[model samples]
Target: MSKKVAVLVAGSWGTALASVLAANELDVVMWTRSEEQATEINTQHTNTRYLPGAELSPRIRATSDMEAAVADAAAVLIVAPSSAMRAVTHQFKPFYTPDMLIIHATKGFETESLKRMSTVISEELECEEGQIVVLSGPSHAEEVVKRCPTTVVVASLDKTSAEAVQGLFMNAYFRVYTNRDMLGVELAGAFKNIIALGAGMSDGLQFGDNAKAALLTRGLAEITRIGVEMGANPLTFSGLAGIGDLVVTATSQHSRNWRAGSMLGQGQKLDDVLQSMGMVVEGIRTTQAAYFISQKYGVQMPIADQLYHVLFQNRQPRDAVEALMGRDPKTEMEVMKLETWEQWHS
Candidate 1:
């Protein structure tokens, strides 16, 4: 029997991953809320709204029924937007079985609970948190569907589960790596979008490579600082889910967060920019969550703080940039203190 995988929510990333599994000759079933979308994927094999101009594999099928998608599946990969993750997982709970491997490709936290996607899924499923694996990295759905060479990481507290997910998604065009730093992987992946938004704002404001480069650099520091304080392995931030994801999201036109930030930088109002995008820009909400997270942890995230003011408080984008540049003199490695480095190495 061919391996079967269920992808929840037929969004761009979900569809792209379904295609990869289909390529591996797995029986792939995708669940969507929209009957129209399910019909399109089932009949036309195309997801025009999320992944326009891309032909999905015929081996991939779509359905609107939750039981139909998850029934007897070898693995269930939840790719719902973070905002919808809890509800979606709750819907799948009735059908979820302990024997089925659970993985999530969703990034970002529950705005209400400030919990990671894996944590949210675990809570809903009533399972050990370690059982849920996170698939993340620099691979954008746009590039992945095109079979552009992409590398990603799947991480879990359970090594066997992580490796299982890695094997299921690995292919010639798409490479997968395994990591045990589940917390760091999730944290880095979510936190990097905040930086990417800042990067886009920098570009939109006509700041050159120097400014953008500095943002990416210090942005990593800010996220790493918080991640470390939150019990994440600092080295994981240097890995794919960390720096790798951060670089692509911050620089690529494919990044919705970056594009949204660019518009904000160009003086567009938050409501206006979101209206133009027509897609969920994770960074906007994430910036809000990160604001409270930084305060709760007592971590100084200068870039995220500036973004919060710019996006929410009507602080001008240029002023945010100026504030970042005009901060009091400090050592470059303040966030990555010597003790933290030693702790990581030890």
Candidate 2:
């Protein structure tokens, strides 16, 4: 018999994972905060609001009761937004154990605490390092649910923990790679959202691909700078969790980050943009967290700073883009190498 796996959060990603697990012929329970969503998944076998046309597996069930969903599961995947991770973890912690693998699909640090999703999970679940794992990459929930080819990374200090999840999710169309650089993978996942927002804003402004390319590249530099200072491996930024994820999120129409930024670029207010998107644009809040983290570490994240201004300080997106273009050019690789050296020391 296949082991039970519970996926918290019945959002697109969570539902997609549950669909995958059920397709794998594993018993899957999806925990939804909403009774209506739970009923849809349990009775209709479709998440009508989020994933419109996809037919979910009959083996997949949904529930409003967290305990019922998580109780029999050998592994628990938490897919809540970063903003809600702490409170959600607090609620689940009492039932957690070191024997079960805890996987976090949420990315980004807390704006106030600057704690990574893994850190928050560790504290809440009181799990050892080996028990915590992070799953991330360019894979969108919508595409994955459709069984499209997608690749992602499972990052953990423990190779066993990483491989365990890699085994769980690897199938015909989905490939999972393992990486020891948990910090890098996690940081890359969080920081890419900020850059994706910039990419969307650029696209919204009708800036050419040249401008979009520059934003994507420079945004990577800033992410690497802060990540290295925080002890993440520099090479991880060149991997799937970094560049690959950035490309997909920044460019895809399905990305809430891109949509939010596009609306902002078109002169819509932040609150209005968020309301229209209906889902949490993690990058907006994550940009605030990344900005504060950079300041605390004394790392110069120019793109993040510019994004912060655009999002909160009322700076125009075009003005920010122009400011970036007008900056004096220096040897770009020099900064990249410096960030690498900082990681070695950190």
Model 2 agreement with the true structure over 1-346: per-residue lDDT tens digits: 2399989888888888888778777889988889999998888999988888989999999999888888868899999888888888888877776677789888778877988988888888877755789999998889999999999999999998899889898899889999999999999999999999998998888887998898898889889878888888888999999999999999999898988888888888888898878888899989999889988988888888889999999999889988887888867874455646864668
Number of colliding residue pairs in each model: 0, 0
Off by over 4 Å in 2: 337-346
Candidate 1 per-residue lDDT, tens place, 204-306, comes to 9999999999999999999999999888999999999999999999999999999998998888999999899998988887888999999999999999999
Q: Rate the local accuracy (lDDT) of all candidates.
A: 0.93, 0.87
Models 1 onward score TM values of 0.98, 0.96
Which number leads on TM-score?
Answer: 1
For candidate 2, give the lDDT of residue 8: 87
